[model samples]
Target: MTVYRPPARKRLTQDERRAVYERCNGHCAYCGFELETMHQLHVDHVIPMEFYELYEVEGYDLDSMDNFLPACCSCNIYKHTYRLEKFRAAIERMPDVLQRDAATFRHAVRFGMVEIKQHPVVFYFEATGVDVPSLHWDAEIEKKYRTGEQK
Candidate 1:
């Protein structure tokens, strides 16, 4: 039996990493959070490598300096392999999701401990007009899917 393996990802050189870090001036491209330490930063692929097959069709470099962004750990973890617009949509739905799922969140809103503001989901890169690719690699999900755990 052949075991499925994800496509190999390229490791960025020190210079490459530096360039990505400076892309957003040491801030997260998604949330604009200042990253004080390099270790706290994650180099994100604008167009994730998981969609390697789309690179040719999309006419964008799948792996290159032009396709990288500087992201804080929180933003990177949250983005988590979603297309840019999809991530924005997910963020836009946060209030509703919280209200429906989190009792504490709903109680906080009721008591004025939390306020849900209405606004478009505008990312830092988008606000600054810095181009960032919208881009999922989910290993556990893939495994579950292959095993018929996911419908």
Candidate 2:
């Protein structure tokens, strides 16, 4: 797996950051903790930024609204440059991590941050050799979101 490094660029303006927080209901997308009570909140890329550089020849807009999510400091640090599948696997192996991240893990699945496939129903992160049960999503729903036809 590649480590995603965000490009050096202007940071999101206060208004833009505020919009993301509001969109996520002022809670950490992964943990659902109220942002107001937390010492800090981080704006995260749902898809690792490194993925864009590695796969997209046209370049990806890392600052796009659809790619951003609100996360608490711990969640942000814990997630680091992991792809969603890897992050989910890590959460599952550790009881405390799972307890703190279950809601967010389910949210990622439902929202299509993590890909789902049937077959043997296993998810594997090649870099880390972590495997876990597959999460499911409605393909049509995910397509709608990906195409900007639905929020």
Candidate 3:
């Protein structure tokens, strides 16, 4: 998979943003939120930028948007680190692959929706500037615009 680093925003424009949205079908790939509903529009790396920073720090490609994935804020938050074990155990059991899929994690583990209270963790991502998933693991199958399957 090609590695991707977000280029300076100044280097991009509306067309690029639209391209991203179109690539993702203008919906949050993780939570399946409609794009029109959320005013926020931004390209998300399916993998977090931080991870690539680590890889680049160790010497690797730092600019590959191929790994990018579009997502809404809520989905992004849930996917990033929205792990609440007790709560998760309480909800409808998550499928094995879904459990590993970050996109499904938040919807499954964030709020007591699945069961535990994650106010502190949720608030942390909120309080900090971080938002939805912009990247995904390079090895991950990326959404190919036509199929729901990640490839």
Candidate 4:
């Protein structure tokens, strides 16, 4: 029952950005693309900040290090304000998007970094206290990979 909006601050300080890049090992969280090879890389909110504001929840800070992830230009642009599940679903449905970044998507799935759930989507990162119904992914697709059908 909430409308999504883009984050207000589009750029991070050089130090902040550098820290995130180093923390993520210079690789995109969504696509695993190397930052060195890409012309631009973005710092993405793992659990979008829009959700935090919409819900007016407690203890969720979007600017914190725990919530940040390195993302390549393509993935960041495509992701926009969609939640993790919605973004992952887009990767699965779109051939062009998937063809280049399936490995990263699969890796996130394998490691439980991203989850699939229906209805009001919520991705809870325990460390960050991010529990909100703003992100989404398909449980069926997750099952396919978990069962080794898609692997």
Each prediction's TM-score versus the true structure: 0.79, 0.55, 0.42, 0.54
RMSD of each: 8.6, 13.9, 13.4, 14.0
lDDT of 2 at 117: 42
Candidate 3 has a TM-score of 0.42
Better of 2 and 4 by lDDT: 4
Give the per-residue lDDT of model 1 (tens digit) for 81-106: 87677778888998999999999999
Q: Report the lDDT tens digits of candidate 4 across residue range 12-119.
A: 778878877775467776666778943366878776666666333343455566667778888888888887768767766664444357888767767988664434
Best by lDDT: 1
Candidate 3: C-alpha lDDT: 0.48
What shift in Å separates residue 80 of candidate 2 from its native position after superposition?
0.6
What's the true lDDT of residue 9 in model 4?
A: 58
Select the stronger candidate by TM-score from 1 and 4. Answer: 1
Clashing pairs in 2: none
lDDT of 2 by residue, 36-105 (tens): 9433769877666665553233334544665677788877898888866687677666644543678886
For model 3, residues 69-149, the per-residue Cα lDDT tens digits are: 566776565455333232234332444445566665667666546543333222222333333333232223233333565
